[model samples]
Target: KYVPIENAKYTLTERFVDEEGNEISPSVVKGTDYEEGSEYDVTGDAKVIDGYYLKETSNTTGKFGKGDMTATFTYAKLGKIIPVDPEGNPIPDAPTPQYPNNPTDPGKTTPDQPVPEIPGYRPEVPSVTPTDPGKDTPVKYVPIENAKYTLTERFVDEEGNEISPSVVKGTDYEEGSEYDVTGDAKVIDGYYLKETSNTTGKFGKGDMTATFTYAKLGKIIPVDPEGNPIPDAPTPQYPNDPTDPGKTTPDQPVPEIPGYRPEVPSVTPTDPGKDTPVKYVPIENAKYTLTE
Candidate 1:
């Protein structure tokens, strides 16, 4: 008599995934049908993958039972170490080190990464610790206490034109350090310091500038055609307000002289360090009139 035999079907599905259950590599599947009482071993780890390592496994070694079985292998992708500022922005030109793909122990930190040196800034942490795969480790950097800055001194006239040479001093002081540019202002001839802008302040992240605005202090002198001072010519006084752009002096009326008529009725000074001429010509005698 022929005996009826029962058979068992089992499926071994090997999956490579990350901690977040995302597959890093393709799945390997195999299936077989065996006798109900047959013993089978079909689950194991997968091959090495670039930039990924075995993290955990399920059903590494299991017997083929009446029901289907599925096995899986999870992996962890190496993480990257990034340098950043205090605001969490990535630092420019900074090195980004990656964690070892096959660490001796999973979920543990890898070797410390070297922190790059940044000019005028200090790293908050000397080194970086690379942790869990697929995550970034940030190294913060802050401004150094002794960082130097530049200060520019400018002496300009009311029209914003430089009256004196500009002084540029770089890498002189640290941030927030107080500085005084009052003494640096020059004593320019025919001009006086009217006001100042950003002349005195504490240094900051950007370059500092000190502008000393000056106004012209000029006078008017009257002279003759021979380039000699006019005898008894009234001196025109400059206006008291130096901020005036015209820099005009009060008009001076011609003085009365015997047997002379002044060339001009009045004289007005227009330019600084310049002379305005006023001539006195001899008057001609008028012929006597005979008519009644």
Candidate 2:
């Protein structure tokens, strides 16, 4: 009884094996079968080997159902991985993959191929290059020729203290690219970003430094006649004249303490170009002398 199996199909599996013949889990193609002239697409599933890159090999595509055919892809080992911070600062502790899996061979050392995912950091694709052919003995793998940029966010208080290690906002521009400074600044707690430099201009050009200036909340300190801070002084308020609908009146009477009279009956607050103005109030009391 020599009856051929109807539509009998042979299994076509693509196995991605490392240099040591160990199969990479991600590289393994799901088991599929095809009859003669039946189409089998591995285009989407084919992945570049890790720690190695695709080379200019002769074989890329072919017909299916050639009797359990095996397609082997060639890859070059990676030599280096140069990781940089968002500000283009080099991260020295970045992982480096070994060449020929050897530690002693300096010529074979290359940067790791995988870009590390650090929270609040944006990583760029790494540049790759083959080992120098001029070396005493040519290496088998390619190395990271240029370091990739990983942008990190920055945040600080008015006093230059670190408030947050990163910014929640994102910028689309790359290093050396012109950035617009006209956009509104990100809001921070208890502080306002001062426009010390050009607020509406291109960055990386003349007087176009992207500098952020944070100003703390305004304060009015009441001092004694001896120029010492007074205890329990009334806090000054800005735009204090609530009666005026326009809120243009900046004069607000100094708060009355049981024993003190203001040197001036009313103090006018000064506008420091902030959302709110600060007013300094000096009070004179016959019971206790107060100074500015």
**How would you encode candidate 1's per-residue C-alpha lDDT over 1-292 as one tens digit per residue?**
9564455455666777877988877887765554444564543346566677666777756666566666677777666777777898987666676666544444344566667676556788787666556677877888676777788888898899998888895557777788877766566666656788887899765467889888866544455546566666565544442444324445656555555566788766655434556676656793444667
What digit string (tens of lDDT, one per residue) describes model 2 on residues 64-156?
Answer: 554554454434455544455555555544444333332433223343334543322445554333354112221122222232332233445
- RMSD per candidate (Å) reads 22.6, 18.6
Instruction: Give lDDT per model, in order.
Output: 0.66, 0.43
Model 2's TM-score against the true structure:
0.33
TM-score of each: 0.36, 0.33
Model 1 regions more than 4 Å off: 1-11, 18-23, 29-48, 53-56, 59-62, 86-89, 92-95, 103-109, 116-126, 143-292
lDDT of 2: 0.43
